[model samples]
Target chain A: MKRILFAFIVVLVSVSFAKNASAQSEEELVQICGMIAKDATFLKDFRIKLDAGDPPPVQRVPVILKKDVKYRFSVCNSKDFEGKVVLQLFDNNRMLATTYVIATGKDYPTIDWVCTKTGAYHLFFSFRDGKAGLAVGLLSMVEMM
Target chain B: MSRRLLYILLVLVVTASVSSCKSCSNSDDLSQDLVVPDSIAFNDPVPVLGETVIEEMMQNIASPVETAALIKGLKVPFNKDFLLTTKASEKFNTSFEKSLALGIYGCDLGYLNMYEKSSFVIDYIQVIKRLADDIQVGQFFDFSTLKRLATNNENLDSLVTISQQSFSRIDNYLRESNRPMLSAVIVAGLWVEGSYLTTRVAQVSNHKRIRETLGEQKTILIFLLKVLKVYEKDPSMAKFLTDIEKVKALYDDVKITYEVGEPEMVEEDGVIVFKQTDKQIVEMSDETYQKIIDSIQKLRADLTKF
Candidate 1:
């Protein structure tokens, strides 16, 4: 009986710690972003959260890009979320750059893009396999030409 | 033993249920807690865009730093004459007025920070803090840290980054609190001040890049008008909208045409750098550009009135 009680308590404690370790808030995401965006001018940050569903929808953020400017797109995903963030920068129908490379099944934490044209660009965010994801996307200006 | 086991099972079930519920709602609780006061009614007879879309537009507004950087790059001397007087902040009584002044001062602060004018920076920061406090968004600005950073010339980059973050945070907070109207006003104020500074400089310097930059604002002004028009029913915003519409009238003549070009991607230091062959062609007569400058100046003067 004592062994049973000890086993249940251990399970509960482990479960509690696991949950605490995984859950990440926006404040935490901002802290993560501070390190990633160091030495760069931060323009804005997008906080993204999507609940688990049969088909998760992609989140799109629109930004104005100027010519001859270098921009850094940095993303940090929550540990609690199984879905790895796939961020794509699009200008109308043209796909400029993405964080996830499908060819090698590789992912990157940042996409450093230089805008050669001045216009509206959209950032589309989703997770691999349409799974629910929580993350933050930070846009910063690295250089201006 | 069975009773004790049953108790453990009940406890486990309750704990699991509670924890799961808490985890699911952790992201949105603060936004829910912000209750809009009964004073200002947002009964939009014709809501142009949803709250979420307006919030996105607010995020996309060009940072004042970008304009200031471009102005500095043009070698235009940092003219303190162009900035709004910090003493004028006291004249803004209403939240609407305070929010707008907050953004106006924010743009001046960015300009000051860009030029690394540490001497005049403290006054603008203090006024910004006062205006932000008046509107309940003061929490975002770390006044002491900003002050300390302002004193040291070496911390220019840090000062700009932190101030940008603070303004962004205030914007996000306003949207989260369901006060997007205020957010729109703040953005408009920032844009107005930024345009005033640019157009004033353009009036004197007549630089091609400055003129091109002013022309680019045609698109930004259109987007801003869309956001501001949503709050037209509010008495205070009605006058603001009317004044801005006059500015927009001038922008209608500024033509921006885009040429399609392919984008090239190059890897620099293990990171992908994208270059586009596409280009935007801005066309505007000198007369029309002058008209825009005059209209923007008029609008800014009315906005900054005591």
Candidate 2:
């Protein structure tokens, strides 16, 4: 009886976990990315998805930034976690900065950066106390100073 | 019976790790020829792309938007004459040619869309649709909506955004479908065509920024070669890879150097913006630069041949 009860509990937990782990559909993700692209100051190039899953698969992008030009990095999410995902920028292993978190626990929607040194930079994405894949990030260069 | 349960549990654990592991310990050594020197880092030893992560590299691949912005910034005239002719897409009949033609016309569309040349947009959209349909990605496009967005001059960004979203869908679909070689080919076509456009402008205008941009493609070439090397066994892919390898050989002598400097942090709109002070400067001889231009033109012509 105990063994059967344990199996039932396991099945119930997995069903609940799978429900939370569901991914956004392709159409939904594309729309989310398109909405994020609208505000990019420069011709925007890529749309990245961040989910807070079991291990919360962190996404890293390698970008070659040019010197003296300011590039803006922005984050957009589904209505559930729009401003909650953390976007971290790094030069190699060293952490440089992250998106702004307001006093009310909301994050600033975008990060504007200037490249004084031209080299490869890594941008890491994750969620704050949320399920994985809850947010999407948009990368664009703000052409004007 | 006990062992059966153990096997299942072991498989489950292994599957979870493979799906979530972020470390690069699993990557086989990349081709030695494709490695970029520290002064010119182009790739990291990242794992195979996940379905969603595939779009991340779309940004890394030089966007048509970059060429559009460059042309606009240089005050260069919007010359439809400079773009690849729409009918040029019809010349190719094979899956390879059709795939590449899709890429070529796709870049041309980027230029046209950026200029908001309403008249030419439909033709290229038709071309892209035909090619994408040939390639089995037609479902990604929303024809009525794109046309609706295009009719309004102010909807340029939205129209383009929708278009860009389609490309992302292509990447996601290809990755999920386990046909990443096609994805690699599409990206190769996009990069080569975008490079061709830039070099063409550089040929006529001889603008320094354009020239610098052209030279910097050496880095993007490294990135491309790394991706292509993964599919080095496909005969068609092998043939294309060989051609790009030649282009890489042309870039062997072209050098890019970077100088490190103090990083900067600025407050913008209540957000702290961090700036890197490191500078990248390209040094290419007039002779080498010309050689690259000629080589790219010849290579593109060969690839685009029907």
- Pairs of residues at least 3 apart in sequence or in different chains that clash in candidate 1: none
After TM-score superposition, the amount by which residue A64's alpha carbon in candidate 2 deviates from its true location, in angstroms, is 5.3
Runs of candidate 1 with Cα error greater than 4 angstroms are A1-22, A52-56, B1-58, B152-154
- Output the lDDT of residue B67, model 2: 63
Looking at chain B only, the TM-scores across the models are 0.85, 0.79
Each candidate: RMSD to true structure? 3.9, 10.8
lDDT of 2 by residue, A1-145 (tens): 4574556557555655554454444345435554553456333333445555666567777765544456667666655444356788888786666774544465666777776544457788776664554565666655633
TM per candidate comes to: 0.86, 0.75
lDDT of 2 by residue, B73-173 (tens): 78777888767788788787756567677777777877888788877888888888888777666666555677777665566776766676667566556
Candidate 2 shows a clash count of 14
Candidate 1 docking class:
acceptable
**Evaluated with TM-score, which candidate comes out highest?**
1
Top candidate, metric DockQ: 1
lDDT, candidate 1, B87-183, per-residue tens: 8888898888988998899999989998999889999999999887777777778788889988766678888888888898888887766677788
Positional deviation of B107 in candidate 2, in angstroms?
1.0
